[model samples]
Target chain A: MTTYTFEPRLGTDRTALYVEVQQFYARQVRLLDDLRAEEFAATFTADGVFAPSPGLPPAHGREAIAAALRAAHARRFGTEPVRSRHWYNMLRVDPGPDGTLVTHYYTLVMVSRPWDPAPVIAPSSVVEDVLVYEDGELRTRERRITPDHQSF
Target chain B: MTTYTFEPRLGTDRTALYVEVQQFYARQVRLLDDLRAEEFAATFTADGVFAPSPGLPPAHGREAIAAALRAAHARRFGTEPVRSRHWYNMLRVDPGPDGTLVTHYYTLVMVSRPWDPAPVIAPSSVVEDVLVYEDGELRTRERRITPDHQSF
Candidate 1:
């Protein structure tokens, strides 16, 4: 198997830019990991939207997305010991008319519980998240997580 | 509902570049539609690789991918109709070490038979294809379809 070198910013010395985006993703993941719902919801813009795509539940606005995340987090943490990793594989950052358009790809992830040598659910694929940055902060201009692979 | 656009070549001419890319994509799709395995496979570089994430089959190398397409065509032909519209979306072509790192998202497909819609499967997001230009013609270096939306 091939491994990816986590460059994060992909060699862009736009240190703040990299960290800004990183922190946003980090915060989102951490909120889920820590089970911090309010904090998680606060990260989104007032009008932030989450559209899983046609035929799927599309939670629009920060409050709606936050609520969905809360329920999902509950289910995820309820059963699983909550060990997981969200890795950014391929990232493309561009200047948009409104803010910085950041397209990030999540390559691989492992979610396992204690006493389990293998992961309960390990995803081997990439997910692209399109984000927008404003006022030196990050918000979901759009987050499109494309599935490179999927397992039950 | 909202919409998205794709761009692979930058600054040179999105119009002409899109037309060029469209031609290649069209040819491949049409060739595949025709069930001509060899010609369909000819769209890629000999070393072209297919990376299908889980819940999907993986086809690597020109010959193997071609064979997979042939089999897939056999199954899909009677069920679906090839799209005439160019559904390429979020196409961003970047310079790679060997060639252009082409990333694009596509899911809007043409329906051949309304009675049976083709199963929404792998590459659940965007069709991320790596392209190389030879003799002013473009061929896939590697094509990885990542889908943002998924079905079972």
Candidate 2:
């Protein structure tokens, strides 16, 4: 028999903070998936750092982030018509220093072609993020993503 | 240029209720994925109704729900070892009559084998659920799943 272990539910559940974070991601992810690079990058702090994977250099700021996204988007979809959706699950929210919020969640990217019956799953990953309120809106200050196989 | 449209965010954001509902699904989906049929069904009310797909007949109660899950699990995993994960996204929660909570969200099933580099995505689906407090805990009273292709 295969034994399954449950992932730990981290931190105390803060209702207001949780809802606010969810709403933030709801808008942010759509921007990324829709290839709205500038809009997506705007959700980050001016000096935000995005280390998409351990092997790649982190994008340093909003301008770099948008450029990186645009380059990736053109490379992937330039050859064919495809749509991708980002899915998030098992979110953990905790309070950080200086009134910031720390969050961890699993992200799955599903890609589908016009003729495909279903989207194909990309390698699953977990993201660690530090968020702070900037002008009364939550913005990501730092984000580090680790693919499942690379996680300890 | 292909026009991209965003799904509407439904209902007012209710922090306590949203967190409660997410925690409920976090526990519930694990049970289902682990093939703990009895425990999975127990998350539903005794008279819960599960309409898995529009074309399939609904499982009328908890017992039937358990049985259906067991049968499906056996058939799928009997020949080969496979792991499936359920991912939920874009949740919409609303208050219902009589203090019930209604939820709508997208569900994606990703299936992987021991040798596969990454999981394969199954057809995407949307779930509509009505939940109520049972014994001080939230329980699903009705769940209706509709595949994206079948949805209007």
Candidate 3:
């Protein structure tokens, strides 16, 4: 294996930048867990694309993605949303070649269904995100959620 | 949604250390791809534990893990090893509470079957690793591989 290097934000104290990126992700996941559709849409760029898996077509644009998320959440939890937590770990931030930030992490979603008293942990996945820093904020350009195993 | 923080390494130029940990992981994956069973076993600590998933029992100790890996590889590829590549991306290194190094990354395995001319990408997963620094080298103390989805 060749030496693999991710020299994003090299020669600088990018600790603060990394922290900000981490916070951005944290906020995004929070919005998702809370079912804040509009606010979650604000986290992405105007033309951001969110791909759930390789087999399915991606939702194009932030608006479309938000609608999809809202529909999915509503279908699963109904009007009274159940308590859920999105745990994101192993956050890594790197600079893309085209003046964007690339971040990746693992996400574990835990929720207490209405019928069950105990929390149920859903299947987890690794998210690869391409983010653009605009107006001093990070926005998603493209996000790909890849599951760990083959579904079909 | 509370403000989450990842203060694993604060106010330190941890680039060198991250690079070292990445190298250790790189070496481990390389040995596995090359089918060097004995050498791959040496990358782990004497009492290291390798858990492929939560549903399955873990392979305790480095020797056992290595033997299992070797047996699996032999079964899949037979006596003659075929070409395969394991791509590890988005590597994140953090400091563990007990002075060990914690690492997480996404791995995508691509292999060429004996009858197939092209390589097929296998299911990918996130690997969470606990590593110890011994004799100026990093060794895997525990590794848990969590798949992104359920296979039924």
Among these predictions, the greatest lDDT belongs to: 2
lDDT tens digits, residue span B11-31, model 2: 344776687788999999999
**Could you tell which candidate, 1 or 2, scores higher by lDDT?**
2
Error of 3 at B34 (Å): 1.0
Candidate 3 lDDT tens digits, B1-152: 11222233522646556666667777888898887877887888778888877677888877798888877777767866478788666566777766777777655567876887877655455678988766666788888885544321
Rank all candidate structures by their lDDT, best first, as comma-separated numbers: 2, 3, 1
Candidate 3 stretches greater than 4 Å from native = A1-65, A68-152, B1-11, B114-116, B149-152
What's the distance in Å from true for residue B84, model 2?
10
Q: Report the C-alpha lDDT of model 3 over A79-116, residue by residue, as the tens digit.
A: 76466556677889887766677889887665654444
Interface RMSD, per-candidate values to 1 decimal? 12.8, 3.5, 10.3
Model 2 Cα shift for residue B150 (angstroms): 9.8
Residues B4-121, model 1: lDDT tens digits? 1223333455444544564466456546534677776777777777764445767766789878876665565644444221134455655555435465656443222222222222
Inter-residue clash pairs, candidate 2: none
In angstroms, how far off is A80's CA in candidate 2?
1.7
Chain B TM-score of candidate 3 stands at 0.82
TM-score of 1: 0.43
DockQ list for all candidates: 0.04, 0.22, 0.02
**Candidate 3 chain A lowest-lDDT run of ten:** A1-10
